[model samples]
Target: MMVEQVEVLVVGAGQAGIAMSEHLTRCAIPHLVVERSRIAERWRTGRWDALVANGPAWHDRFPGMEFAGDPEAFPGKEAVADYFVDYAAKIAAPIRCGVEVTAVRRNPNGAGFAVTTSAGDIVARHVVAATGPFQRPVIPQMVPHSAGLRQIHSADYRNPGQLPPGGVLVVGAGSSGAQIADELRQAGRQVVLSVGPHGRPPRRYRGRDFVWWLGVLNKWDAEAPPDTKHVTIAVSGAGGGKTVDFRRFAAEGITLVGRAEGFQDGVMHFAPDLAANLARGDADYLRVLDEADAWALRNGVALPTEPEARQIPPDPPCVTDPILSLDLAKEGITSILWATGYALDFGWLQLDAFDAKGRPRHQRGVSAEPGLYFLGLPWQARRGSAFIWGVWHDAKHVADHIAKLRGYLDYGAPAALEPL
Candidate 1:
């Protein structure tokens, strides 16, 4: 096997990897980005058909690159993928697609890393694991295996038609879960959205998008939450975006249930916390309003005052006293969309920088293990570290560190594609 050597090796071609490449290129550092599939592969294939970026295009994009048309418009899933593809080309990123990294181990001879990939072995002075979050789709263990119910993770869900005939039970109220559930309901399918603890930010508040409010409030750079519990945000970008109101959803006949507890005797049980979950979500929304209002007062800018913190549709019966359990067959729910989210899997990287949870122990992408680095991890640096706008800062920091390494190898020529 031929061993390709480089100054730095980037293990993904997604936004983080590309941003890292851009900064490295600016710093005149030679590096190669390898991807398991094409650039922005997840955006291209993983998300559902109705998926749109949570943030508006202007906010979601990389610096100096702009998504054409309305800046506030949330780009569709395919558009986001195309944006990455175009951005990679713009930087002329030295990326090899269709090359899958199987494992990574320290170079036994001396320093750096020995990366084993599908194509061939590669040695690098430093390795940046730019594989952003969402590595593995996860369904909670509490969800039982029922013979008739087709369980689908958000990653595999493309459209409602792809699901088996009958109503849908979307368990989990995260961004993906909430959006998926709403999409199903809008398609005229019966949907029971299981509510959970979540951050509810109104799509438009005080004559500005949520992105603007977050920016003005400096919430983007806020410290990442201590816990790694999956971030469940009740916000949407469908139909030009709207405030995700579970009350309205309940009032409209979509059943709102509490968190999934367990399964017994062929029935899925839900917790009795629907009202609490809804209140928490509403509280988050109102808190945003309070902060925004305070900031306006301090700045002496008179913004439209919402006498009501936010419009709260009357609490429906489903939210107050939710259904505790439902037999899959009896409820006519043929499919269960487990938007429970993903758990990061770094099992391939033979490094000691990770905690017991398999999360890299890094101070903003710079791993404790010298040559090994991580980028685009959730809360890797700040609240924004997980998004495109924030990941660039982390990438620049990592690239700058890599630039200060002991030695620099000459830029290697691009490798020829081998027949797989």
Candidate 2:
């Protein structure tokens, strides 16, 4: 009923929201961050308990805050949630948890914006949609309604013990699917992983983490094409910095299937592209390694030689084999884990600033809608725009723009705030 006014309103209290909030705080911008649930809700509840950050702690640090423990060690999901909580407190972020934004629209007078939330209505001079890109779980429409089998999205999966006592079919061989299949297999469950196009990078390459090399090669800054499909890299800490590629999965006796097509007549159908997918993945992986090696050599960075050359494992023999369909009952698979990834949902945002695909039309983080902005979106400015370490630069840029717009402070170009 009553309206509250603020200089800026940031929606969502995840890593992106917190990062943007901290920057705004530094700029002395009056703003409030409202979260639908607790801070870092996805890290707290949307991930498996065994899930650790894909990258090391040092690379995952938000601006002005570093991980207190071992920098190279990967922090688990709970640890990540705690880090966000601590970071929020340390920055003194004006955040109101448990408050969900219902709708957001520009003011009729074209002054600022009107933000409707579960708590109350707020008129803000600027609104930053800091909600990360992965907002909704994308379950394939072809998934059949099987009465005997339990189906769950990767976001809802916690552990192997949660599922019934039977085999598991993990659909989609992305990072999550690969890791989940590995976890289930290690837990003594019969696991079958549906193969798909992915990037299979080794956990560590040449005494350095693959992520470190990616950083060195500035791969994170690489711009993706506008219609580029998201590719998930198969690397996890569950196996102690181990790579979870299809070859390794096959070696571990996990059944590999082709891309999941659909379910028909109580049987799951798959495309007969297993060989092509495996070949493509292998080629891409080798290309990436070659590029990294070339970059290191060009930069005159000497890599430590192994006393004994590492023996690369042979490619899995199952690539040529293709299983077109499988009856779940016959295969004894009682559960299906849909690691099919996520799609962004900005339906609540009442603005014409979005493209045809529902993504905000913004340069970096600033939108043409004036007071409207976006943060933590995939390929927003660069390849790493959606990552924890990557969002800070965009946050700083958005904060600087907001401050300048409000006539708070002139911090010159956004490039001036680049990390030292």
Candidate 3:
């Protein structure tokens, strides 16, 4: 087999990968970017039509290019994909597409890494794994055994047009679930959304975009002393708001259900949220929004508002009307959509240094494994590590640090790998 060598091998040419590539290029670092498919295909293929970004355009930019449109407006997935294509072209970021990196193994002597692809092997001293956290959608075993309803993960869902003719049950109350439920209800599908601890929607804070304020105030920016716990809370609480709120979903005729129980023959059963539990999802979200506002207040930052906030019509009720939970399958509920959260899959990575939860134990993007680094993870620096606009700040830091590493800084030769 022909051998290929590179000084630095950056995997996955999505937002994170592209950002790293740009940084490497600017530093005149010899590097090769390998992507499994067309760049940004994840956003192009995985998202829905009505799916504008969860946040504003200004908050979805990269290192060099700002999103081209109304700063306050949200761009669709296609627009994002197009932006990536143009950005890659503008930067002349070399990317080898259609090469799936199957395995990444550390050199036995602890020098570099071996990146095995379907086509061939790439050896490099420093390996940056930019394959983001949403690589795969996890479907719980509890969902598969549901007796009669056809079940599909939210990843498989493109739009309400693809849902079953019968009423649809959406599991999870995260951002994806809420948006899916809204779309389905708007499409005239009787929709039920299983509630979870979702982040709050900013009803109105100050007079500016909450996300913009977060960005300007450096809420998602990395700090000298990393606050992982604070980072997690910031991101998990209100980093990205759901496209639709419970009130609007309710007004749109979407049923807001409590957490799902085990599925029985064709019937998807749900546990009722107690009187106290009722509207808990909305309350939970509002609490987070309040917290965000309080954060701005405490920090003495001017709260910035969305430009179009006043223009957009008043939201429909957060809850859809006549949205009552009925037994699915038994009650002719034919389909289930799991909008549950996503999990990171480092199973193939085979790192022994992971935490008990299988997460990489690291400060920022530095994993315990030497020469192996991760960037663009959710809350990696702050709440912005995963956001397109926010990733650049983190990527710059990671790339700058990587560029200083002994092996990474060398532009002379690709690190050699021993015989497999």
Candidate 4:
């Protein structure tokens, strides 16, 4: 028996879920948004204190509301959380926080879903899995465990002071790993940054933020997801936005190492791919510069030239001849911060709407199984589909689909997402 019913049910009250509610309300759809914890809980808890939004303020906001402060400044983690909270309040979204959806199953007797939650069971005609990406933290299975070294995933990392008084080794070269390692080293701790496959995008180009360049070039909406999903971005928003230069880091004494490969008694081994990885990243940086310059020339957009935009140096000797192994005790490294990224977990979704790798199988978030949808997936619709502004567009598209299904309105042919 259904205790309650609604036209649409949105899961996870993060930016994606909240965006869904906004569009649903606009379409006059009767729905409710459910969150496992408070709205934007991850932003409030799962991030480091020193973290800032990866995108600039002007580019990463909803179309309706403006973020307070300088438009070019990157809002800190707390401010970003507050922005979502304020957006929810402004829309008067019908949201119920603390209602955790444990399982979702198709209604065997009808065209709906039977959802079991911490609050109560409810039947929804349409279910939107707006859980977003970054579902679960993933550490490599090969990472050895030892009581001597304090190990924690990036989600659990709060600050450099949270760790013991010793050197720190941050594994992975993504945004989170690089930021954390920089913090540790700035605090006078010996830090080793494990290099991996990463894209080095310049923070600024041609007197404008790189984000502006991406929008004008349609790189955000025009690009498609690559075959290898392991490539993480190397950029920083600490003091405004800046390129993540490993060469500069090496010059600054933040030792660069290869990907973490092995661990033994009080020791960790790395691959000899530091030079290769840096070379790959340098190539990526050059490619962006080349493309941006060409685009300007083609469009005849005469912008002020940025000098450092084309001044990336080759790898220094430190980056080329990196330490292949680390004896933790000998190096005085007492902490291992794993910024290894996340894995998808749809264990509660009792639907065959996923591929073999557990990635959602949906065409622009509309599942093959009718009435089921996914939102806020990375590259679900395009490169920008996972960003804050991108989520707004995706949610509106989904809401339009729901409205059209119930004869609310007609939705035209939107952009077709590529098949995964």
Give the per-residue lDDT digits (tens) of candidate 4, residues 169-261. 899988999888888888998988999888888888778777887887788887565353557988888867888888888778888899899
C-alpha local distance difference test of each model: 0.85, 0.83, 0.68, 0.86
Candidate 1, 1-420: lDDT as tens digits: 467788789999999999999999999988899999999999989888889998898788998699988998999989999998999999899999999999888887655778888998888878999999989998887655646578889999999899878999999888888888888888889999888888898888777888889998988888855575555888888888888888777777789999898877768889898888888888888898888889989999877876754667788988656789899778898888998878898988988988876778888788989888999898888888889889988899999888776334325543322311
Top candidate, metric lDDT: 4
lDDT of 1: 0.85
- Candidate 4's displacement at residue 373, Å, is 0.5
Which model, 1 or 3, shows the larger TM-score?
Answer: 1
lDDT of 2 by residue, 366-395 (tens): 997888999999998898888898998889
Per-residue C-alpha lDDT of model 3 across residues 50-117, encoded as one tens digit per residue: 66676667667885788886776667888889999899999999898999888888766436777788
TM-score of each: 0.94, 0.93, 0.82, 0.94
- How much is the lDDT of residue 248 in candidate 2? 70
Which residue pairs in candidate 4 have backbone atoms (N, alpha carbon, C) closer than 3 angstroms, thus clashing?
Answer: none
Task: Count the clashes in each prediction.
Answer: 0, 0, 26, 0
Segments in model 2 whose C-alpha atoms lie over 4 Å from true places: 306-312, 315-317, 408-420
Cα lDDT over the full model 3 = 0.68
